[model samples]
Target chain A: MADKKKKKLTPEAQQYQSYQEKREVKRPIFKNCIKAFFVGGTICLIGQAISTFYIYYFDFTEQTAGNPTVATLIFITMFLTGFGVYDRIGQFAGAGSAVPVTGFGNAVVASAIEHRTEGFVLGVGSNMLKLAGPVIVYGVFSAFVVALIKTILIKWGGL
Target chain B: MLVGHQTWMFKNKPTIISTGTVGGPFEANGRIANDIDILHDDMWIKQDSFEKAQRTMMEEACQIALKKTDVEKEQVQFFISGDLINQITPSTFTGKTLDIPYFGLFSACATSMESLALASSIVNSGGANYILSGTSSHNAAAERQFRYPTEYGGQKPPTAQWTVTGAGCALLANKGTGPVVTSATIGKVVDMGITDRLIWEEQWPQQQ
Candidate 1:
């Protein structure tokens, strides 16, 4: 049986071997890097622009300007979420845009839209806070604990 | 975060004059003043799971304000705050914790700024002394009413903002020892008439 297995390959096997000879192509490294650099840089530039706008137009001090900038970004992201443009940006920017406050707005609006078909009150209204609920809960809870400690200290501790 | 509190010195102790909220009907208290105290107490709206958190944050902010100033919680003449939640839970909870003469307000996101303005005016006019004014927002609660939840992986637009999931409190003393609220400006709501709900496009533009 072992000697018999050494026979020459049939023509059918040779034909199959020839079919698998296609070459694999590689993407240009420079092009990929250039694209990444521009896209990433553009996001940073937008953030800078927002900060400047708040400072110059709103008369906000440098420190306080961050609030307005975040507000503006949120507003923009909300509109985009409604128009269905933000999802694409998220894909490209990865966490660049999603890590900010604007990302939170996008999550809320998008989820609302997803559940809108369920009806106004039950669908959209009920599901609206699904994504942002934790932030509110934790934010409030943390603050409450702080207040409790402060109250105790002021009331009895005399600090 | 600063865990400890510090006291400031002044020749005369500053008194809390007034406190107010924006998202409610105004009462006629005709008085003039040079400076006003305002707190952004109404900025956060409440939702079901967020009730406990809102109360907690309001209490913390108020505590910070009280601890920083010499006034005791009982000595506080009034506590003013508001939100868009049912019965104004944030403000109500805050009132219960502080256990002072309290007023609830509602004005959506503008609550905090509006409250600060009112507090400033009261302090300048000598209505009361040592007023505690503050505002808070919980992302979870506000999103439930206004948007969506965290489990959803839905896309977001560039314009939307993650509501600050935190609370801020300030002490309003008439003596002008600490940083005094200088002015409060009210902003009117404006709609840009954007009918396109799907403003953010879901696809990235392909590189040409």
Candidate 2:
């Protein structure tokens, strides 16, 4: 059905709906906000620490360290997902864990782990991207579009 | 092995005299809360670990059945119970407390029905007057074993089942006012080509 029709009032159905609404517990928005802030901030802090470490140890410029720092974060998240620790953090932190690139890495690795039973080709290769595919597609396409716009502005508008 | 699809046909009808059930807070908040004999406030059951909590529920369920019919612990011949824990420790520990002749079983979710079938066959054949058959699965304990830890907050796919943290036990005897078990059939293992773990987990329960 495209849309559910408005049905005639049944006394029992009305009573049941009312009961369900009454029993529903309200979500604590403030607590959730606090949790998300702390967890997301912690992830960013760790990323900054990694970037700083790379700049100092590898003698890299602040500009060059960004790529390696992201790789490191994703690497760390993948391992944590494998070891079954990232999921715990994800649970405790909710959106805090999800907003970071690490969460994306966790999602990809978690799906791979889940589908490992179906063999490498069909299971790991195919299903690994099942959850991560859409995000990646949009990311690449948007980046391409931005680059195209930049080129068009530089060419036609004469810088 | 001389067995060829061997099935047990009992001469006497085994009756479920009394049943005892215990559930976690999740089930207590569920629609069928009133149906459960005992609804626990928390999953831990005042125990230190999830494993121990599962054991307490299992033992409590048997105790409830025994208490309802005024049957002494010593009078009940067997404690055929199991839980979704490593080595079936909950059943083992509960058996230790009951001090009854135990047959610790492990058939995952099917343990409840399997144990009932086994107990009914034994009772019908004059093995014992009363036997307690029970099985339990703590959501935390099961998630820790078969999947990730409960604290992990891992998002499960739609096919993933919520492991019900509850224990249910029934005392089967030759005469009782409850439902009677006329016959029992042991199942054979059949594997289909369903490759997904979540799908497999969901399918196994439905098959039973």
For model 1, residues A15-117, the per-residue Cα lDDT tens digits are 4434532431333446545644665567557878989887888878989987777777778777888876776776455444555566677777877876664
Q: Write the per-residue lDDT of candidate 2 for residues A26-111, one digit (tens) a residue.
A: 44657766987999899999999999999888988999999999899989888898888988787677678877888777767877
Q: What is the C-alpha lDDT profile of model 2 across B8-72, one tens digit per residue?
A: 66668889999999999999999999989999998778976777889899889988988899778
TM-score of each: 0.43, 0.59
Judged by lDDT, which candidate is best? 2
- Stretch of 10 with least lDDT, candidate 1 chain A: A20-29
TM-score of chain A, model 1? 0.59
- Candidate 1 residue B149 Cα shift, in angstroms, is 2.0
**After superposing candidate 1, which stretches have Cα over 4 Å from the reference?**
A1-159, B1-48, B84-86, B194-208
For candidate 2, list the clashing residue pairs, or say none: A88-B152
